[model samples]
Target: MTTQKNTDLPLQGERYISREFFAREWENVWAKTWLIMGRADEIPEAGDFFVEDIGPESILIVRQADTGIRAFYNVCQHRGNRLAVVPDGSMDTFTCSYHGWKWGLDGACLEAQDAEDFTPNPCGHAQLEELRCDVFAGFVWINMDPECASLKTFLGPIWDEWAAYPMEQMTRVQAISVRMPCNWKTVQDNFHETYHVATAHPLGLNSVEDDYRLTAITLYEGGHALGVTQGSIPARRKFGDNPSLGEQIRMELQTWDLNPDDFQGREYETRIALQARKRQLGPERGFSHYNKMSDAQLTDTFHYTVFPNFATSINSDGMLYLRALPHPTDPELCVFDCWFYAAGAENAYTRLLTENGDASRLAGPAPREWRNYGEGTLGVILDGDAVVMADQQRALHSRGYKGSRLAHQERRVQQYHDMIDRYMEGYRPR
Candidate 1:
């Protein structure tokens, strides 16, 4: 029971780069929360979409059928034009360069180009406007308030604490969005901290000893948030840090059996953790989260934020999405998606050696003066956490700064600034 580092909060760190709090956080927090707008396998098919913006809306998302997935408002209710402008394809309808307003693919508004433009069925009284879309856990949430609160009440407990992350049979090798300049709460204050992973990890930073307990700091109620940590098994076993202990015990028994194709093919991960260390027993009956990993901890480090924006890093040498996208009111001009995932069948040789960079930081793991005052090693963990989040967003528009407080181990950054101060205090709950 000892974990504290609020390090003086400063209102969710300067109202996350304010501009009168970014136009009242785009009308009380991105138009009534539940955000996370796309990635249902990136619009699987059937007229797909992928516009996304949500900070004063821009959406689209669509992916009808095969189990619906819709979101609209790329506009076209007729005299509002701007409908789908290729950023991602597939479309059975959606036309309106300036006149031809078609729509469909479940956004309705059938057609309206000529044939008398005054009633008598003007595209059945126009319809192309439905922004509610759901699909949590596989991702694709949206809500421009047509009667908010629902995405399981804005994913209260991170949809069952990420229900054993098979994350919809995981699939996605690269996505990288990028635009970066700053705020989005300075990238969630640099991923809420691993204490800057012994110097901002390029890789090496898992010295696993034990007891780190931070497992619960949720704040769900529209602007949802989550952060948890786990550490235990550490007795000693570092055959050169994770090299093929049966391919890390069949990828932790295929991420707890979402199926790594039944793991009976070949390299049964060092023949099942050397036969579960000769039947050790008891400890959630180890089938493999690297048998409660500890030779440098690797069983549960599950870091997920996703609230108010994004930040994901489910490990196993895979899955890493992290969006920010601010700057319409210039919260400091932002954008950064930084994604990566390499699924089964060695995802084409681990995505061709992560495209030759081999996940560089000079391929991590080297003493390099164990933070001897940091000359290198993850360049002091990405240069002292990007020089303390760019001088804390430049002394938060300094004038000799005034705000600062919150520290009970930064209660998840003050429950993400009291859930963005309960949506800048307007929380339209109807």
Candidate 2:
């Protein structure tokens, strides 16, 4: 399990394709880690549910009588037919499609066809398997191991670092289901570095909106490393003349659109309000601007990772909610979903998400990088990410590239590897 150079320390090939390593991950990583289950707001009403799989288990995200979200095994205790087939919806209670067995959101087994045969009515004795469910930021996260760490400690100091962006404020713009060939880690790791930015998002680099890069990376002891980039630029310079240094700045000045007022005026205009704030705040200060703003000058982008399995991209206009769930026995084949949340652009959201008509204008090319994965696909964003991850998965199977080195400037990526090693090596136990 030795890694490559410090910059490229994470295992590329073996970790990606080895069934043995994938098993170890299920036991060590997926089984114990605080994995994201579903968006919190999606199931805000009572009895709403979404089925998500983590490693070897199918997690049923449930909305309780108290209007709180809970996680349960989506299995029937009697016959084991999957309870909820649809990915998401609302229900008074869940009835097994196979048998007429029923359970409430609290997981109480309320009904069984024949009660007399099973003695004490089968109500309290059999309940859907329950797991620890905690709501954080805007998503529901569940842990299979009841003895795992609290979400706060698991996230380390990410809150202070992400204090500014109004994460809850942004609406879910798009929710897309895309299945990729690569492991979830492959995609997550790919996103955790700007090392691939120059090549991966060359058009993304030179867009008119904002300049973003790696300076926003964060590494902690508990396998948590966040690499974010802002979409901002200087007053005199064009985009990319001097790219953004890190994730913090990306959170501050990235291109985000919000609910337009009656007159359609955002907090700040692109040239004056947004860039002025970035230049004034400078690069030294981490994003804690929510309290500092006058309420009129708070437009910003927030592309941040919340530990183990969630990454959020909040632009001034809207946001992209990304959830990476474990892929059962085949860790490399995890399910990735994206939800776009926008303030005033639900119309635009639907159009861009659907890639309605030649939407490539939405994504500007990166002048610095070159591997435009979703070339000529019109204008959908998820297609681009899917193309990149699937291709990376294919490359991982290749024997030609074992692993490589990382630049010291990419400390966040290094820190990410160190965290993974710490956990896999048995040093940091949840």
Measured by TM-score, the strongest candidate is 2
Please write out the lDDT profile of model 1 over residues 1-430, one tens digit for every residue.
1112223435543565657767776777777776674458766787877786644457787787555887888878767867887666787887878878787888777877673756666666777778777887677877788788677756667677565444555555555454445677776757754544444442322222112243444545544455544322221222234332233244444433324444333322422442343234313432233343343223334667756777776653345666676656677766655555443324222443244434332222111111211233222334455456666777777667666564454466566655665666765433
Clashing pairs in 1: 5-409, 199-381, 200-381, 246-269, 246-270
lDDT of 2 by residue, 280-322 (tens): 5533343343344433224333456655566766554345667
Candidate 2 structure, TM-score to reference: 0.74
Model 2 lDDT at residue 356: 43
Deviation from native of the Cα of residue 240 in model 2, angstroms = 7.9
Worst 10 residues of 1 by lDDT: 364-373
Which 10 consecutive positions of candidate 2 have the poorest summed lDDT?
364-373
Flag regions of model 1 displaced more than 4 Å. Answer: 1-27, 30-34, 37-46, 49-60, 63-70, 73-102, 105-108, 112-117, 120-127, 130-169, 172-210, 213-302, 309-313, 317-342, 345-407, 425-430
Our tally of clashes for model 2 stands at 33
